[model samples]
Target: MTQSPAPLPPPKQRRHLREAASLTQAQVAERMGVTGETVHAWESGRTTPRGRRREAYAKLLASLTKADMVTNTQEAAPPPQVTVCLNKKPNPRRAVSAPTPAPITPTPITPAPITSAPITSTTRTPATRTPASTSAPVAVAAHGPVPASETEPAPLTPLTPAQAFDALYAFCAPALVRQTYLLSGRRELARESVEQAFQLAWQRWPEVAVDRDPAGWVRATAYEYALSPWHRFRPRYRHPEPPPADASDRALLDVLLTLPAPYRRTLLLYDGVGLDLPETAAETEASTPAAANRLLNAREAVAARLPELANPTALHRRLAELASAERLRAAEPTTVRAGSERRARFWTRAAVAFTVAIIGATALTVRTAPTRYEPPVPPGETVQGIPPRSAPGTLSDAELKLRAKLRSGILHGPQRLIPLAE
Candidate 1:
């Protein structure tokens, strides 16, 4: 009795056949008149093709694989050669002409035969050769590849100002806020710091979008602002309830809080935020070596608090787990409403700052101004106007009459006096 062939696993068979035929899942689906997801489902072992669909799929796979094999074979084969006979036929349009005799006409033009010079060989090295014409020397770069700094960076992703802001906020806000929260140990401060950073980013999106590390820029800015002393006096500082901690976490938090701020930030950034020592150092305003030392010292301190964490491997593993949990918890999506509120708050703060500056300038101007001065004079005394210098002469009767008439006019009249009220 003939034995039946063992059936192949669906996913393996599908993947092998598609890859062998150099086809994508989508391409296979297109041939089968099914959605790409359906093909993915079959190949991922999530669902199986059945009945008529299964038969049709098998047939399609067989045909495509066969066609691919035939195409490859044809491409790999060499071209055929064709031979030509030189003496096959001459055209009847014109037969080759016989050479005519160049007879006695050349007798007068005969001359002595010229002597031939001996041939000689000389070797030339290509490197030392100079061009026949004057030319500038060509410089060859010794370096294998141009350094990244020497190359112009590609343009930033083509995004409208609004789209850039939205995308950056959506991608980085949660992570930034989370990192800030780990630093400040307060949700409200974290939220405020992240919002402020994003506000600045939105206002300067052109610069920020082209930055090599825009998210890093945002995080560093948020961190600096969160640590500012002015936040102590904010009336609206509402601290949200801390995330629930198990016994181990409570112990970890106790140890973390007891450490110095620098050590704590280094450890958090290294493990919690998955930043390397150089990056953590830059963010915390410390040198890389200093940051490394701080991390080691902080780890030892934590080990003292929890003896079981003394082992480096165990410590790293536990920290990694904690960081994973923190990320998962902090992954809440930032909404449009939140962004709008942040923008409004930013403008409000800006206006307040501008008004304060204006008021300060005005006060300073008033304070520094020179006081007006009037020459001291006795209460009852008046300084008379200097009399005009004139040539000494006796005036005629007509001139004297004119002067007297001018003195009687309104401009030259005596001033009226009014009595003060008792």
Candidate 2:
């Protein structure tokens, strides 16, 4: 008798299902509200789905494969009617029936026919689980494949950008928040930026997943979005940072926001994206020299605006800092205005009024007081850095003319930028 081959992986089934449904790892997490790593573990069979999720995953696959079958049927035979045998959920009934096989061959039950449109990967999620590396159970045929089992189970699946970023943020939101807070001068905008950036990342999971630096992509995107002028017009809400899910969460996003758009854009490409000037130029659609000039000018302008922060001499400045989710999501829509700035404005106006009162008082005091002068000396002797009149005890004609000319300046209104002498 031919020995039965090892149970095969649903490789073709999975590939087709993935294509038909366009499920990315990020979308998988978004669908299930789980981490990206969890989906990786599921595809690798490190963990298994339970309860409603197990049914969701199985149903998604079944429906997707069936849809593909309908499309391919234009030139080929239709898929044979499939009797989907669902696995039993954990329960006491299963314990009672655990050892009992059906008494004999029983009639198969017909599952309901499904006709939903293909769910976009951005919206729907795949079954996700954590890797059970230490005690992984062997996967029996999941009703997906029963025909081929030649090679080792096709190497575990890959994650899409959306999925990877979802995983990264799931693991590192807190730190991202803290970093974002430090990067952004204000907290509310940073928190929203992080959240919005991750949401966008999920929408484009495939391309993002394969990207060399998805975290960088997300960060760059977040900063750019926060820097948009429209963001300012909209009333900002608050969400504090939480415990970070990963190490890369430590990037400060607020600093980029503090700078002008042109400078921030330059910094995002050259620094945040880790591109050299030429690559930055290409990515930003500018010439290399122009990119380089922008970066330099931006840096100079940013430094000038924040002298204390620009200090290269301050070696203790951390290149990275850790943050957590609790903090990222903590700030509410309120509590952003600086107390000092508000108070300073009020005090400044008060001080101007006070100065005007003092000016009036001084004018009254001057008018009420009498003026006096001292006796003049001989012409040869100097009095207050000036020649005295020629006659003793009397002012000379030339001395009187000079003193009057000097007093004319203070008696007049302010002079023009061009010299009065001119």
Question: Candidate 1, after superposition: displacement of residue 115 in Å?
Answer: 83
Compute the lDDT of residue 415 as modeled in candidate 1. Answer: 62
TM-score of each: 0.43, 0.32
CA shift of 72, model 1, Å: 18
In model 2, where is the ten-residue run with the lowest total lDDT? 112-121
The digit string of per-residue lDDT tens for model 2 on 169-217 reads: 5433444454455445456777777666666665565666656455556
Query: For residues 392-415, what per-residue lDDT tens digits would candidate 1 score against the true structure?
Result: 799999999978865665353476
List where candidate 1 sits over 4 angstroms from the true fold. 1-157, 235-243, 311-313, 323-372, 376-422
Tell me the whole-model lDDT of each prediction, alpha carbons only. 0.60, 0.49
Q: Model 2: how large is the Cα RMSD against the reference? A: 24.2
